[model samples]
Target: MARWQDIEKDAPEFAERVRARFGAGIHKTIATLRKDGSPRISGSELEFEDGEVKFGMMDRSLKLLDVRRDPRIAVHSPSLDPPKEAGEWLGDAKLAGRVVEIPPAPDSPHQDAGHFRIDITEVVLTYVGNPADHLVIESWHEGTGWRRRTRE
Candidate 1:
């Protein structure tokens, strides 16, 4: 686990890229464990605020049930395809995090709903440029923001 400061000094440009790639009307895949210990998957918009990602669901949604049963969850943002030429963005990233449900607000759109936050724990970066096949992993934990876990 690496603190936010441990990673390359806040790469605003890179952060912007990430936000643009994953944030633009993109849907995130959320996976949680069911009461029976099975995996339940759902897709929802990835909302970013104060550096954290959030998802909202109706109380009747299976996702809310799953999260209530198990807080551990994983989220993935699909790969963005760029121009087939060099100088274009050519990589994909996935985020794995822990989910924490937020209490619904009475006047909120989710008032009859539930909200879950995905606290990013790890990130996987895969490069698809040229020869492709390059990958990198970054892990985060308490007291740590993000740290390189592997490079290949």
Candidate 2:
């Protein structure tokens, strides 16, 4: 897995898109593995701080518990339908990795919170094009770096 700093250094262009898409809204979708190995999706918010991507949930929350038992996670930026004219858009983004629990600090403000740091394994950015053109997909993996793909 790759840390946010490494991603930024190794894939600056992709990291910029990830940051833009993630910061476009306050809410995002986080996917975790349940105890029974089923998929669980929870609404969450991401913070890009200290050169890391972090998030938290209420202590003992189902999502929190899910990550504690199984750290694998997938986070998707808030879905925003592209405008009719596609010159600019709140691009689509996704992050997948294992969650690293952050122990509450001695002076922590939210004692009832469970914090997690994302150790990103993959990042994906999807953007729109003209109606006749294909959607552009840019992806980065832990060690594979960035690649571009397109689909109609």
Candidate 3:
């Protein structure tokens, strides 16, 4: 497992890449644990700011409740296949993290709405190819980028 401290040293560049590739307004599917240990999946837009991934939702949503009960969550960016005729390229990334509820910012868009910051604990990157080998697997944290953990 890669140490978070080492990863922290390269946070800025890593965060910049993530922001450029999968920044705000990008749709992410989050899988949260239910009270009974089942899974609950939902979609939300994610913003990476100040080294953290933040998501907002209505205060009354079941997803908000689910996270409160259990902070473990998995997030994936939806993949779109490039047009075969056009020969466009396609790729996708998956992230798993622990959720931390940030205090509502006064006069913020989500003030009345609820917001949660996800401290990414791990990440897997996959490209469109035969067998879909994971290009990278690492221990990641908010602010810090991904660091090689174990080979997959």
Clashes of each: 5, 0, 0
Candidate number with greatest TM-score: 2
Candidate 3: misplaced stretches above 4 Å?
A: 1-8, 11-21, 85-88, 128-152
Please tell me which predicted candidate would have the highest lDDT against the true structure. Answer: 2
Query: Candidate 2: deviation at residue 90, Å?
Result: 3.8
Q: Can you write out model 1's per-residue Cα lDDT over 8-125, one digit (the tens) per residue? A: 2444444444455566446767777888998888887767664656678777888888777777777766545666663355455566657777765467865777776665556554
Flag the better candidate by lDDT, 2 or 3: 2
The lDDT of model 2 is 0.87
Better of 1 and 2 by TM-score: 2
lDDT of 2 by residue, 35-150 (tens): 99999999999898888899888888999889989989999998987776775665799999998988766897987898888898999998865463678889999878889888
